[model samples]
Structures are given as C-alpha cells and as structure tokens.
Target: MFYICDERGVWPRRQRRPSDCSSQLVRVKLIGEVLAPFFLVAAFEPIGLWFTAPIAFAIYLSFLKHQHRTILYSIYFAFTANLLILYWSGAYVGVLPWVALSLLQTLYFLPIGILARFSNNIPLLISSILVMEEVKARFPFGGFSWTRIAFSQINSPLASIVTIGGVLSLSFATLLLAYLLITKKKSVAYVLLSLSILPSLVSVIQDSSEEKSLRFTAIQGGTPSKGLDFNSRAMGVLNMHLAESYRSVKGDEDLIIWPENAIDIDPLENAIVREKINELIKRTNVPLLGGAVLSEGPTNAAMLFREDGSIGSIYIKRYLTPFGEYIPLRSISEFLSPYAERVDDFEPGQVLKIHSVSGSKVSSIICFEIINDGIVREAARSSGLMVVHTNSATFAGTAEGDQQLAITRLRALEHNREIVSISTTGPSAIITARGEVIKSLKDGEIGSLSGEALILLKISISDYLGGFAPVITLIISLLWALSSMRRKDNN
Candidate 1:
C-alpha cells in the first residue's frame, strides 16, 4: 500500500498506481500466514495431527524477513491456535472469559517473534520458541500448562526420553528434528535422524526389572447432573459416589481412590458421613483415599482411611484451581462470568501430602495439580506410587477430560511410576511406569477400575532436576539472540 514518487511524477495525474498483481500477492501471503497456525491447532488433541507444528513454524519463519508482517502473523497465529485448542474452556464458563484467556496467552508469542527476527540459526529460532512456551507455562498465577507441544506426542516414537529429561526434552527433540529437516544438510540431518532412533536404543538398554504389583481400584462416580451444576446437589453427589462404592465389586484390592470432591461435605466433621464411610470400609475390608471439601472454610482435602478403620493423615490439595477453586480479583472478574461469584475461595494446602494406603506409599495430586511441574516432581521423588484425584464433572462432554488423561499418561512416563487417575465422571485409568493404560474407563461411564501396577521405587532424572531444562534453554536462547545482534552490528 506504499508507493515511491518518481521525479517526473510530481502531479497526481503523473503518479502511477501499484499493480493489482502485487495486491493479490499480499492477500495470498496473508492467507498462508493465517493458515499456518490453523494447521498447528489441528496438531493438538481431538483432531490430533501431531506433525503439523513444524510445518506451521516453517511457514511462520518465512515471514521473519518482514518484521511488521512477522509480528502481525505471529499474533494471529497464537490467538487462533489458542482459541481453537482451548474452545473447551468456554464450555463451562462463557465465551468472553475463554476469548480473554486465549488473547492473553497469545501475547507470549509477540516477544518470541521479535527475538526470532534477530536470528536465522536453526538452533536459536527453535530455542526461542521453546523458551516462549516455558514462560507461558509458568506465569500470571500458578500457570496454565495445557496443550504443550510435548503433550501432543504422547504416542510419538520419541516419547521414551521423557524419563531422562521430562516433557521439555520431548519438545526440544521435536523442534530439532524440524530444523534439521528444513536445513536439508545431509550431515546434520543424518545426525538428528540417528538421534531420533535413540528412544528405541534406550529402551533396549533400560532396566526391565520385574517388581511385585499392588492391587488398587480407581473409582469413577458419575455426577448427579452433567454440566456446571453437576455438584448443585452436593449431598446427592456424595450419595452417588457412595452408591458407586457399594456397587463396585471388590476383588483383592489393596486400596481404593475416589476423585476430587467425591464427598462435598467433610466426613471428618460430620459423624453421620463418617459413620457412612466407616460402614463402606467395613464392607469392602480395605483402606481408601478419597477427596472431600472440608468446612472450616472449605479446604479441598484427601481423606485417608486406614485398614484398622482409623482416619489416617488428611492430605490437602496443594495447588488449587485458579478460577474454579478460588476466584482471584473477584471484584474485577465477576464481570467476566456470573459463576465467578459462585466460586468460593478455597485455601491452598501448605504442604505436599503423601500417604500410605494399605502399606503402599502413594502421593495425592488433586485435580489440575498433576499438571504442575514442581508439585508432581516433588511427589514422584518422595513416593513410590502416585494418584490423581480429579473432578471432571464440570467438563464432562468436552475434550477437557480426555486432554487431562493425556497429561496423566505423560506424567506416568515422566516419573516412571504407576499412577491411578480417578475422576468424578469417567476417563479414569491405572497407568504403568511405561505409560501404558492398563485399564481405563470412558467419560461419564459409571464404573470402577481394578488393576495391579508394579510399584517403581526408582526416581527419574526429571525428578531430581525439575524445570531446569527449560530454564537452561531460555538462557541459551537469549545468548544466541544477543550474539546474532552483535554480529549484525559488527558488519
């Protein structure tokens, strides 16, 4: 839309208009820019075209020569990708909050595009994007660590290295492969191609130790109602879970776990509820770890019942759900949704709680806390087994529960520990150290999973050095950008 004035073209009549072909070319480029990130969205869950991220990035990189165009393209891509993948966010809450969230997250890409414009090196460009993802995963609250590029490759060939370096490692490997392929430098490409086969190599050399297994039941008690009002009848919700417990055919199960908010009323305070649970314990003849909303201001806690019928240590949920568990800036946020006012602020647990259920030591992660790096890593280091107690009742029909299950599968691989993820409304499963779902239940299915898992006492490298990989990558990216800028100045 800009024009150059020729010396003879001083008058408007003498000036020439740009060609229509140039305008048409701009339109074509803009269309491709928009489509690039659209394909990236398809690479995530539900549709799950896992290979599109690199292609999308390549298209994005093509725009870097024009800085203004690159910035606009990056924003458009980020916003579109987030909006598509996170459409489920608006399922419970309205569209406004969801759109706001997507827009806020898109801003993370703005600086990334600016930094990427400074460097043409494959490694630097790849590292900058990785660092951008890391920042988005850790800010403005406890962080929303959903739809990470690594999560898309749960079933990928390179999933094995997760034990050595965690999810960020998987992301790094994927980006590296993309870069090598694009460069088409046979030597570098061959090196990366060979490196990609190492997961199979590591699998051959890794310990295939056969440990004794412990039996556990992951209970999925259906909600009273399906949507946001699923827990409207709180006591009825408790009764439904209690009914599901009695209905469960107990085999030689060592322990039973219920999802978060299985018991809306605190069994500890109410003698009647306590007596009801005690009766179930006597009938099942097994200890249980189930979630409860305790009343000295409604703390989300895991109530552990001992085999001796005594109430064991209550493990409180450390990381509470940001808006759902407690609405931050309630006064300002109330405008976003009427449900904001409906949310009561629950206090975050002071300590990470790992308890012994019928002799097997299991760490409890309530709801979305399983997505947190520090919390999950701490639990994996200390405990032999891990359990995620979640209430997916709010997001029953959406892909949210399935996405959460995907995350749980990655966690099982990352920690190399057996995990029992029990949900309020289905997608419950018992996953092994190798990330296989031994047994699983579908969404909204009123069922319980009884399976055995080998208790892995060994911890992973990620357990020892949590979040360090991303931090190191971020520093390297900054240095690479600075070095590139310096070279340009010297020229």
Candidate 2:
C-alpha cells in the first residue's frame, strides 16, 4: 500500500500523515477567516483600527473556498461587522432595529460574495466591494452610508486618493494593494506601494500655498444635560446656544457658525429669538450662520445673520433623516415601537442653497446631510467653503459623533476644501483640505473652535464625476465576470 505523507521530501526522510496536515491547514484557514472580519469591525468609530481593515479583508477573501457557502459566509461576515460598528443604534432605538438594520446591510454584500465565488482575480474582487458599497449608499431610504471602506482609511496614507477619485478611489487603491499582498504578488505590491506614495506627495504640494483666509468662530453649546429630552426643552436648548455664542466670541471673528438646531424655535416668527441672535451678531460685529428650526411644518435651516443682525440667505437642510427627522410608514412604525411618536415629521427643503458669507461662498450641510454624496457634490461645486451643522446631543457618549467626524474629514479631502463641522454636545472640529484636523472640541464638552479658513474655487475630479466611477466600474466588473463564466461553461 502506498502512503500519502504530510511532510514532503524531508531531509531525513521523515513522513507525516496527510489527514493530520490537511486538517491542521483547514482549521487554521477557518479560524483566520472568522477572526479577520471581527477585526474589520474595529476599523470604524472609536476603536479606529484602520490599519487592520485592508489586511483583515484580504484574509477573509483568501479563505473563500466554496461557491455554495459564499452567500452564507458573506452574510455572516457583513452582519457581524455591521452589528459591532452600529451597536450604538441600540442605545436609542432598541436592539431590534439595530439588528434589522444590520441584516439589511448584508444584502449589499451578497453581490460581492457571488462575484468572489466566481473569480479569484484581485481587481475584480476589489471592484465588487466598490459596487456593493455604491448600491448600499443609495437604497432603503437613501441608505446608511456609515462605515464605508474608505471611511476606515480616513487617517491612513490612502486618504490622498480622496482628492483624485473621492471615497471610491481610496477604497479601490487600498484593496488593490491588499489583494496583491494576500496573493504573495510581492513585486507588484511593492510597485503599487511606491505609486501610492505619490498621491500624498501631490497633496502636500497642493496645500503648501499660503493664501487669503478669514477667521471664524464655531460654537458648541452643551445640551441641557444629554439625552432625548433636550429637544423637549426647546427654550433651554436655545438659551444654551445663546450663552455659548456669547462665551465663544473673541471680538475678532469675521464669521461665526453655530451647531444645528442652535435655535429650537423659529427666529423668523419669534421677535424675542431674533433679538437674542441679533444681539450676539451685533456685539461680535461679524456674520453668523446659525441653525434654526423653521415652523412651516418645521424646516431645519441654517440662516446667515449679517453683522447688523439682518438676515442673509437661508440654507435649509435638504436631506431629512428618515427615522430621526420623520418616521417612515408612520402608522406601521408607531405600531411597532413607541419611539416613533418622539419624532415629528420634518419637511425637506427643495433647494440646495449656497450663501455668500463675509466674502466666502459657503455651502452649509445640516447634520446628516453630510452623508449624501449628491448634496456634498452640490456644496463643493457651489461654494469655496463647506460647513456641516449638526447636533449629536441625542447620541451623546456614543461613537456616532466620532464616526461622523471621520466622514467629515473624508469630505474635506474629497473636495479639497476646508470643512468647519460644528456639533452640539461636543466634537466640533476644523478639517483642512488635506484631511487633517487642525482644531477640535471633544464630545460631551461645551467649547468653541477658532481658525482661519481659506476660500478656494478648486473642484476635484471626483466632484465633477460624482458617482460615475463606482457605477461604471460595477457595470464593467459584472459584465467581465459573466463573460468569464460563460467561457468556462463552453469549455
């Protein structure tokens, strides 16, 4: 009988059993596959294990052995990763909704799973990830775009790709290097790594110029204690912002920006509210972009107040958050949970308004509006400065604020413009065009950020193309995969 030895061509002719060696390898591979995705979950939010993201994903892809188990494994991986990253959702809306949302995100990975099963080519797999993320960014009520692959790389070397092709480009380049490393394509990996260094070098050159700038003050008013109840105490919330506005004033600010919902009551309708806001603007002798809730069925808006307290143009929030702002399928949602009653149906603004504030064309995105690519694209095209006015008081103590800040950093790089993101209940920051956080206010703190920001009309290639890169790449990948499968079948 011929023996199949585990140890092949040993120096001393030592032989090992095939079953034991094969089983050991299989066990190691399985353990690696499972552990890889767990680490991927850490790539987001507070933990920010960003360096592990590409490596973890590469390991997961390496062990994708069976076509029949592709969907099952992918669902498991995506669900677990999303569940960990989005766990904070449970603190507000309950565990059920969080689980349901995580499950929904799994479908986004289904296509990538199928693609991985059919091909071993690295580029195709990377393209599949982009396609999955692109699809998930759009569906099910303007999709949950948090924890995108590129978001993990916000602080990494790959961030330089943002100015070139936006978030999708960074993701593609990272995955390319990751795949090459996993496949042991050392020569190609080294070459690509060298090329990756070029983007960061180019970014440094672009941001080196000292240009004209305007000094601005950003106010973060701590909520009347943190929780969902702060919104109920509208007057107190407004007073808090008013007080902070007074405290933050340095007397030299050319412009002042407040966090979203700074005025819980409509200033246009209330003389008392208008007077208080105008008082601050007048004292500072600077224009202020203050957030307010307008009561034509409650519109979330950022109204620009001139030095004399005269109202300039208003930029109302265009993308209203589905559950938080307006409960979808209200009747059904209310029946499911009592939390639905807490949210009033907020009307979305029809126009993407750009305001000329103190010589700078400002595109203000209120709160969650920063997540929408189209909204951000319009903002970049319309103005030289981008401001994200947000209130994270409800999600206080959670990683939601940090995650949002990370996304804002990506936006700064993507547009090659400075972003002043001011949030209530802390973590207000100033991000430069290079995606660097020059200044910041920590979460759960009451403070202000003062910085000099430049006005630049430069629009990135990614901004011009919008979602074209991912959509076009997705179509090409799917077609290529189909053609390859057909050729194999014919043979």
Candidate 3:
C-alpha cells in the first residue's frame, strides 16, 4: 500500500505479507510473550528454604523495553512474577493477596511503555521511565511503590548513591545503566557500567566497620493465635517480647522496639498496658518504640513511649489497604462512600514525627508506610534512623511475610539508615545502614529476635556525606576520555 524510492530514485509499491505468514508470526510472538513473564517470575530462587532478590530484577527488566507488546508483556510478566513470589511462600491461598497486588501494580508500567513509544531518545526515555513510574506509583490506590529498581541494588554496591540523590537518585541511576546496556556503543557503555558498580564498592567497605552505630533490639511476639482472647493473647505476646528486650538490655543497650499490634489492646483505653510498657522501660532503662492501637475503630497508630512512660510521638498509618482496611462502595467509591471512607477510614497521620531520645533521632513507620519510598526518604532527611513496626498476621504466616521484610532491608541501604523491622509474626530483622541483614528472628516462631542495634555506627560513605552525585558530575571529566574517540571520528 506504500511506495519506496531507492538510491536510484526508482519507486516500487510494497505488498503485504500473506495472511498465513502474518498469522504464523503472531502465534510465535504470543508463545514467546507468555514464556517471558513465566521466566521473569521464577527469577526469585530459593535460598535454603526461602527466596532471594535475583528474580526480582529479572521481572523488572522484562518490563523495561520498548515494543508493540512490551506493555502487555510487562504486565503479564510483572503480575506473574508477583504471583510466583506469593506462591513460593505458601500455596494458592497465600498467593491470593499478591495476585491482586500484581494485577493492580502492572498498571504502574503502562504509562512508562506508552511514553517510550512517543520518543526513542535515550536520556529522555530514562527520565520519562523514572518520573512516570513514580507518578503511576502514586495513582490508582496510593501507588504500590514496592519493588523499586533502587531496591535491587541493596545487596549490591549501587547502594552508595543514596547518600547523593537519596533513593530517588538510585532509581535514576538504575535507568541510566539499563539504557546504556540496551544500546550498542562500547565507550558510552563502559562509562555507564563503571558508574553502576560504584555503590557496591562503597557498601563492602562500610558494612565492615559500622562506624558508630547505636545498639538496639527488636522484638517479635507473633500474631493472635487460635482460640485465644485478644486480652490473654496480648498478655502472652507481651511476656515473650518483654523477655527478649530484657535479655538484650545491658547497661549499654540504647533503644528497644516491638512489632506492630504486639500490644493488642487500644493503649489509650488500657491503663494497665501503658503501665506495663512503662515498667519494661524502667527495667531496661532505654526508650521504647512499637506498634500499639492508640484509638478505637481503626486508629492503627504507632506510639513512641519514652523511658518515663510518657508518649513521645505518634505516627498514624497514612495509607490503608482497600478491602483489607476498609471496603469501598462501588469499586472506586469504596475509598469515598460513607462506606468508601477514604479520608475518614482512619484519621490520617498528617506529619512525619521524629522522636528524639537519649542521643539518636528515630522515626517509627507503621506497616504499609514502608511501601511508600517518599515517606522513608522524608523521614531519613529529618531523622537518623528508620524504625518499621509491622504485623504480618494477615499474610497468614507465609514467605510473603519474608518478602515484605526483605523489601524493607533494601530500604535501609537505599536511605543509608539503620532499620529495625519488627513484625508480629517473626522476621524481626536488624539491618545495618547498608541494607545487610545483621540478625533476624526465625520465621513462623512465637518469639523475639534481639540484637545490638545501637552499636552499628558505620555511617556509610554516602551517609558520611558528599555522595556519588559528585561522581555523576564527572560527566565533564568524561569529556576528556571521549576526546580520543572524537578525534578518530573527526579524522
């Protein structure tokens, strides 16, 4: 239907491929597309009995390209990969929630794919990918910001960039590397690759010394067990965690933390619970931070109790899960209807609360807040450490619980902050500022995991300040390196 002129200026009309040939290519394309997502999901291989991060990046890359079916392929790949992450933890039942998350999260990549089609300029493409990904992550239900590209480098050296751009900078760097590798130039590729490996180099040296970390302990008392009243279950949970805190509390232990809902009763209404926490603080002689129900009808707030038993600061969960937290009215209005209850479902904790006690400043993020990177970044800029108090009971004691913990581990590295992830159903992990898991509680156990969180003072080079952004400024220095190539091209 179209005509083309050759070098000789002769024109020829083009003919369409045969119907059978087109059909065959479509069939081949479909098969490959289906296989891509499946392989993407299986990337998270088992470590001992649990999963690790290799597959996470694999699924993420499967969505990074530009193609006719790339969006569809990315969605299939992302959703299926999430499904596998959920399935690997338990059975079909365990995967149900994540299946829903993936279905929604696949939308996060839609705008990215659409944007890539409009232009092919690599720099523009990179910016569009990062900004659009960030934007979609904020829409259609508070944006599922989990599985960010920067998170993939937590165990790797690329983590150092956090000291410069914060985690947002790492995400941008990740896209830069992805763009460079996807291209065909050797010199340009070498420069990008060298920059990509810088974060890991910084992390290896920092994880060794921990500089001047303050010793801290996190306690997990497990979830509400079967046949137990909320009050007694609360007592049982309280006793187990109390025992752990006591063990870790030397005259030197700086702070102590407990997982979300560990104190099951609404702390505002229960004077006895408040007194018990105060007693524990008095005995341990350290400030305590943990999850407590501060309000009735779903206040879902985390209260910071100073050693004197006075409330220091409160961080209410700003984001709540749909259906899990409150049911929406129609599908969309559930967040708004009298039944939707978006603004009122829980009194939204409006400000980031940083509690200063003893020597260090800490921010307590209740469950679901860590899924939002902006909250952690804002908290990090204002505070020294980030404390996550989460209860994974609703996850039904599966590896999905571990996946959540692992994601937080990465956040610690991305922001270069010491992280204490205290979960009600085990996996109470102590992660250094570089995102390495120092110690953790055994999953599915009804006990606590305690460690010297205060003593870990290796302020990352990124943390020590003057981060890799200066290195990025080396773009000018690269002009010298490229001069040789430029001269050859000129000749």
Q: For each candidate, what TM-score against the reference?
A: 0.88, 0.90, 0.71
Clashing pairs in 2: none
TM-score of 1: 0.88
For model 3 the local lDDT of residue 31 reads 69
List ranges where model 3 is wrong by over 4 Å.
1-33, 42-71, 85-100, 112-127, 172-184, 197-213, 226-236, 243-252, 282-286, 321-323, 326-344, 454-491
Note the Cα lDDT for every prediction shown: 0.76, 0.78, 0.59
Look at candidate 1 and tell me the lDDT of residue 267: 83
Q: Candidates sorted by TM-score, descending order?
A: 2, 1, 3
The reply for model 1, stretches above 4 Å from the true place, is 1-32, 65-68, 117-122, 199-210, 475-491
As a whole number from 0 to 100, the lDDT of residue 184 in candidate 2 is 61
Each candidate's root-mean-square deviation in Å?
5.3, 4.6, 7.3
Residue lDDT tens for model 2, 387-426 = 8999998889999899999999999888888999999887
TM-score of candidate 3 versus the correct structure, residues matched by position: 0.71
